[model samples]
Target: MSANIEKLQQVISSYFGTSEPIDESTVAADIDGWDSLAHASLMIRVEEEFDVQFPMEAIWKLKNVGEMASLIAKLREGA
Candidate 1:
């Protein structure tokens, strides 16, 4: 896995309290702790870790881990 994806998985595992490895196809709906509140918290953690702010539109559109990683890469590239 790429470094970004690995870091993303780490954040996700920490947020969701899951030891199971997450992959690109992992969606919010696939996790037990991925509720609305957890989603918000996860976003915050991701922003803090990556030092990037996600626009509201892009935030809501993220459906899976792969998409999140892609968005993070795009945002970092633009930075």
Candidate 2:
């Protein structure tokens, strides 16, 4: 679980260009650079990293790092 969170953190940091302190509590609205395009890019990166495809609704519903981690876990389970 810790390793998964670390990988997700790395992916998010890579997408955002720096490790700007994030967690499950870090919301999209709270992140300064989070926009639609970036969100799309994040989804792509996450999909590639986790080897799973997320539904559009899931993509839209992801709010923070913790939520993303949970989503990844769920997708991994289904996979």
Candidate 3:
């Protein structure tokens, strides 16, 4: 896996307190304790970790772990 994806998995695991490994196909809806509140918290954590800010309009468009990782990578590249 790419470093970004690995870091994203770590963030997701830490934020959601999941012992299982997260992959690109992992969906927020499928994870335990991944409700709206947790999703917000996870997003904040990801932004902080990557030092990239996601626009509000784009936040809600994220569907799965792969999408989140891709966005992070794109932001980092543009930075």
Candidate 4:
């Protein structure tokens, strides 16, 4: 995995208090604190961590880690 991917998973796991590995296909519903409110918080955390902001519309569409990574990559590149 890329360092960025590893760091992303680490941040997510830490937020959820889970040691289980997270992958591209991991769904948000499968993790604790991944509900609507936490989802928003997660997006904010990601933006802060990656130093990039995402569109609110796009944030609502991120259903899995892969989508989130792709969005994050796009935002980072745009930045």
Candidate No. with top TM-score: 1
lDDT tens digits, residue span 1-79, model 2:
4666889878887777866876667777666688877899888988999898988888887767788888888888887
Model 4 has an lDDT value of: 0.83
Ten consecutive residues with minimal summed lDDT in candidate 3?
12-21
Poorest stretch of ten by lDDT in candidate 4: 1-10
Descending-TM-score candidate ranking: 1, 3, 4, 2
Tens digit of per-residue lDDT, candidate 1, span 1-79:
8788999999999888898779999988888889877788899999999999999888888989999999999999999
Candidates' lDDT values, in order?
0.90, 0.80, 0.87, 0.83
Which stretches in model 3 have alpha-carbon errors above 4 Å?
none
lDDT of model 1, residue 33: 80
- In candidate 3 the C-alpha lDDT for residue 19 amounts to 88
State in Å the error of residue 73, model 2.
0.5
* Better candidate number, 1 or 4, judged by TM-score: 1
**lDDT score of residue 25 within candidate 3:** 88
Q: Residue 51 in candidate 1 has what lDDT?
A: 98
| Best candidate, lDDT | 1
Error (Å) of candidate 1 at residue 69 is 0.2
Weakest 10 consecutive residues of candidate 2 by summed lDDT? 22-31
Model 3 vs. true fold: TM: 0.92
